[model samples]
Target: MWLKLNKTFFGTGTHIYLCAVYIPPLNSTHTADDLLNLEAEIANYSKYGDIALIGDFNARTGEQADYIENENNSIQFLQDMLPQDYDLDSPIKRNNLDILNQQGNNLLNMCLSSRLRILNGRYLGDSLGYHTYFSKNGCSTVDYAILSKDLLPSVEYFCTSDLNFLSDHVQISFKLKCDIKQYINKKDFNNNNMKKFTTYRWTDVSHGKMYEALNSDEVKNKILNFEITHFVRNEKGINEASKSLTEILDNVASKTCIIKVPIKQKKSKIKKNPWSDNELKDLKSKINNLGKKTKT
Candidate 1:
């Protein structure tokens, strides 16, 4: 069973499909059926632009070869090969278990055929190949994050959490590189508490640069044909025109202005809070260190 969530970037036309899956575990009857169904699902979703399959697959594919390399001069399976990493656990040995079952072989074949890469032990967060599932019986990695090899540019990081207070399966997470500005806070009419955004330090930017940008051909052309480009009489047209101009200015400012984030000036002296004495800070640090285990 699985659920799919798709997001399409407006201007770029990039479609990202995320599938959360839970394949039934291997048993006397359902192993073969599950493998076939999984392969079909992959085939169907691979047609989309960029896709990721994530969840507990129940297949213990430990360090198995996900690709079929050059076997002989006679039969050639897939020319596009999976990237090799010597630093990861050896192909002959795995961090969790050396045993490979029938379910594992089925998963390996499916990945090889579908050109999907498992982002478990090789990627950033869980690069140590730590086990993702723990129980009274034993510990192994059953949860995985799989992605189409073509999405290598979009996949930023992959990791698994060690803490599992709720269930036997630990949490797994992966980040996709996208425009952060899209998710930034906007004005909310429902809530009284407003969101704060990083402000621009206009003084930090050069006046000459700002003048040159506004007087550039792109801005001049838009300003000249502003009326012809937009209908300003109606409320909708007025809002549209305002938004277009705002986007243009924001784009230009993004290139020229510095954001007002925390930074140290070389000439300025550091200011210390009045209440932050060395002794108090030491106590606070000890308290924080003690609290981390309980909170995290």
Candidate 2:
């Protein structure tokens, strides 16, 4: 289906035509060839100064094609579709090496024309939470951008991250210092027509009642509540620290009891017994007394 967006912006006369069109979603009965035809039509329309064809083409580029032994069909589709003068580059190419090293899945979301120079480009993996938006389990790149080739030299930095503070798709942006010399050499500047006109003064737009009402009891209470909460947290932290210091000092000042050691005793050797004369005399007297008693 072909649709014409009839709004002409910036005074139309085929000098520099800038357009943004919504291409049909992929795999909707229409084949890749159909998408190519759509791209060719845009290329035809962009024959003027510069053309930037952007949006999700749904065609995978870069590392996505690295594994396929025969990428001719896909590459040929893009070459035939896009204008020959245009340049193509995926900012995701910077992460392509790392992706390949990790054997990652590539979605190839970017392309540029030869007319455009790539100052910088990258896949916003984790810096933007792009993966979470897509419902992908982990961080990955599925967004990208391409700049005109003429604009490459002045590029300062090209980069991305997986921070999910914005849209789920990774945002690709770049900075370029416009070559003022080119415009100067082209004699595009007219100094005589750039003079400033007369001046004007400013006036206050606030209402007298509104200014007075801003200092209401409700506002004062809200401000006081915030201050009280902050002060309470600070005071609580100080109290906790003071109590911890006292406990630590008390533990350090406590007296400790020391243990004493016992000494070892040596054992004596055994002595042999010898017969005595007093023991022999006592035995003879006991035998004689016993014999006399028996005779009586």
Candidate 3:
């Protein structure tokens, strides 16, 4: 299992935490305790952000018309392990199936206790004609996307597709309706546009020159005769006065100081790996070309 954290969802400041997991098949060496431990680990991250747990839990939920008994303890383990906040959702809902197996009963009991509504059941109605997983015996929906209550509104579509002909298990896709505009901040935009200048280094010679310029008869007279009334009588006027002062200071500094320009360094070439020679480079290039053609 792994947790993927996304700080930005479209343009909104909402955070989304997706926990992807896979429970071993019934015949595997892993025990029910292992599945319970995995659920506990997933629950630890749910408090940080909106959680969406999507995975293959090998439990045979008796939601299909031709339901057969499977001896998987995943459903019972998960039902006891998961927190009260999480909701189990699946495309396949109980309709044609008259009997509830151990897995189905455990899942149903968890939903009832948590007051969780299944997303597929809410949107797609009672039954799904298509199944997610196909086997020699029959087809069944073993994969699921369990989500937190807060994420339900954002869910747009949830269904299965048989696009991957190589695999028996069909892919399940879900769409979320995200509003991009909510993520942009106007204050950050204004801050980016604001101008900032670096302070000039003052040597002894430059300092003497600036002192002489400031003490000159013409410069002294300008400062003495300067009046606030010359500009408008508001915040804009104060800004104008500040701009004039800055201009005078800049002029003095330009005449006195020898401004330094930072030099840009040339980037050195990357040394090739000793093991990767011309033969490996040629092989990699051919593989990339083949991949590009396949994509097109």
Candidate 4:
């Protein structure tokens, strides 16, 4: 195709074989065969380590079945005997593409063969799979980010940025899980810092309420009246605009979104029995006899 780069990152827990590619465009000298070959080359490294393939594949894989889904009416015994296919719970991917082409089929085949899963429609940010490439010819999703099953769980967020960043194709951004279990609101990252604030999961906000509030005239007017151009003018302006927007969102979110604070369970204390006397045992027997007499 055009160009490809392979980089290996060694982590404490795992090693990632990242293969970035810029495959040749659709009707040119390069074609879908190159995509299959790329998958083969990438799959070859699975023997060594985990894989993460991200790049402009020039392959518009619209709303395609990237993985071979398990048979709905498969027999339990047969399924157990042959568990080659991945998880049975196949999630539906909502895409923005109008149609799936040959390149899409080839791309899906590559994903299936490579044992990789696309992160676009699967993540919170790109839940509605946005088109990555746009031009006069039309819009399509040619860029992609795929990861091994193990690495898939670690992806905290994934989204495709708009072309406002000075590019014909939208940029893809993703985050990996990190330990931020507890912390004081910007005080210090130290064990002694016990003054921790109750953190609310903003990511798990009520989208229904959010959209409703944002679409309201009150919120919409606030957004419209505020100078949007000032957002990119200067650092001070950016912060000011961001704070204003955050305030507006937080105000509505406070009313709608439920706060998810982790419950801290207090450890239970156990005490030894105090009845070590024979007399107490006899008294208990007498009480039992009295209770039987009362019943009779």
lDDT for each residue of candidate 2 in 1-296, tens digit (9 for 90 to 100): 22222223222222333333334344456555544454465466555444333334333333443223344556676786778784333332233322321112212212232233222223223222122114455444333334433334444655554455335545545444433343243333454333232222222422333334335564445445544543333667657655655443333222111212233345676543465466877898999999999999
TM-score of 4: 0.52
- Cα deviation of 71 in candidate 3 (Å)? 30
Task: Name the 10 consecutive residues with the lowest summed lDDT in model 4.
Answer: 1-10
lDDT of 3 by residue, 1-296 (tens): 35554566364335666656576765777567545565465466655666666767555554432222241434566677778775444333343222344554444444333333344333443235345678788766666665665667777767666635347787766766767556656665563343233446778787678768887886676676564238776779768887877777776777678765444446899899989989999999999999999999
- Reference-based lDDT, residue 79, model 1: 33
Error in Å for residue 217 of model 1? 70
Give candidate 1's total backbone clashes: 0
Candidate 1 segments whose C-alpha is farther than 4 A from its true place: 1-7, 10-13, 28-32, 71-98, 180-296
Tens digits of per-residue lDDT for model 1, 57-138 = 8878877776555444323343335344311211222233424667777777887778777787766787766787787988
> Any runs in candidate 3 off by more than 4 Å, and if so which?
5-7, 11-14, 63-118, 124-129, 181-296
Highest lDDT: which candidate? 4
Query: Poorest 10 consecutive residues of model 3 by lDDT?
Result: 64-73
CA error at residue 45 for candidate 3, angstroms: 1.8
